[model samples]
Target: MTAAPVEGELAMVGEVAEQLRDVRRHVDFFDNDVHQARDLAREADSRSLATETTVAGFARWLERLEQSNEALRRETATLRGHHPPDPQRPPRHRCSRYAPPIHLSALGEEAGDTA
Candidate 1:
């Protein structure tokens, strides 16, 4: 009876040791996971900061462009006020440079009449 109890106690001790080793392995795996998560979070933070800075730079550039556009508009209005266009003359077309001036005799030929 005494020998049987001692054998059972030794078997329980071996099982407990195995379980403790498994627990240690799980703890190590969990620690590695935490470290990787922290690294990922840090990388995300850096990328977000870079994006924000780039957006801010673009915003400033856009503001400057708007101001320049407004100034050019004001200048154009001032110039137009100084030298108003001749209302009696038609606005010139870009295609006018590519073709000869149309005459009244050409219109008559297209209509089958010499007017």
Candidate 2:
């Protein structure tokens, strides 16, 4: 009878040990997940910072481009004030497109009148 009770107690203790091992495995899995999440968060933060830095650089470049364009416009206005357009010359369009000046005198007199 004493041996039977001792065997039963050992079996119970074995079951408890197995349960503890299962709990430890679950804890380890969740711990690994937490670490992975932290790593991903850090990576996202790094990318966000890089993107912000690039945008800031672009903003600075755009500001400089606008300033240069404004300066060129002011200089062109000043030049146009100093030199009046000849009545015989064709009027220029307000555009960035460049057209080579056509010498009407080089062409026949009739070709110049075709304009």
Candidate 3:
């Protein structure tokens, strides 16, 4: 009958419409997820850049500190070399004044004593 055929055609059209709606919904959800992922990636990249900059700054600071320390060490060595302790002052000998001096010649008679 013509009525039966028309009903079957209408049913097919309804099923196709439902499928199309489902597909559109899935596409919208996927688009939203992709946008959120991109935003998160951008945020992570920004944080990494900030951290890298901070680390670089710290490295430069450490280098400067090392240079300053080296300069201080050189200054100290220069001062020590230029201004030696006075040697004309009396020596602080722990032994008694009457003790005989220990000559190097007594250690061995092989070489002549230089002292």
List lDDT for all candidates, in order.
0.87, 0.88, 0.85
Q: Going through the candidates in order, what is the number of backbone clashes in each?
A: 0, 0, 0
What does candidate 1's lDDT look like per residue over 1-115, in tens digits?
Answer: 9999999999999999999999999999999999999999999999999999999999999999999997887789688674434679886686864767777766766665533
Q: How does model 2 score by TM-score?
A: 0.68
lDDT digits (tens) for residues 6-71 of candidate 2: 999999999999999999999999999999999999999999999999999999999999999978
- On residues 22-55, what C-alpha lDDT tens digit does candidate 3 reach at each position? 9999999999999999999999999999999999
Judge candidate 3 at residue 57 and give its lDDT: 100
Worst 10 residues of 2 by lDDT: 77-86
Off by over 4 Å in 1: 1-6, 82-115
Error of 2 at 98 (Å): 14
| 1 against 3, candidate with superior TM-score | 1
Question: Which portions of model 3 miss their true places by more than 4 Å?
Answer: 82-115
Model 1's TM-score against the true structure: 0.63
True-structure RMSD, every candidate: 8.1, 7.8, 12.6
Residue pairs clashing, model 1 = none
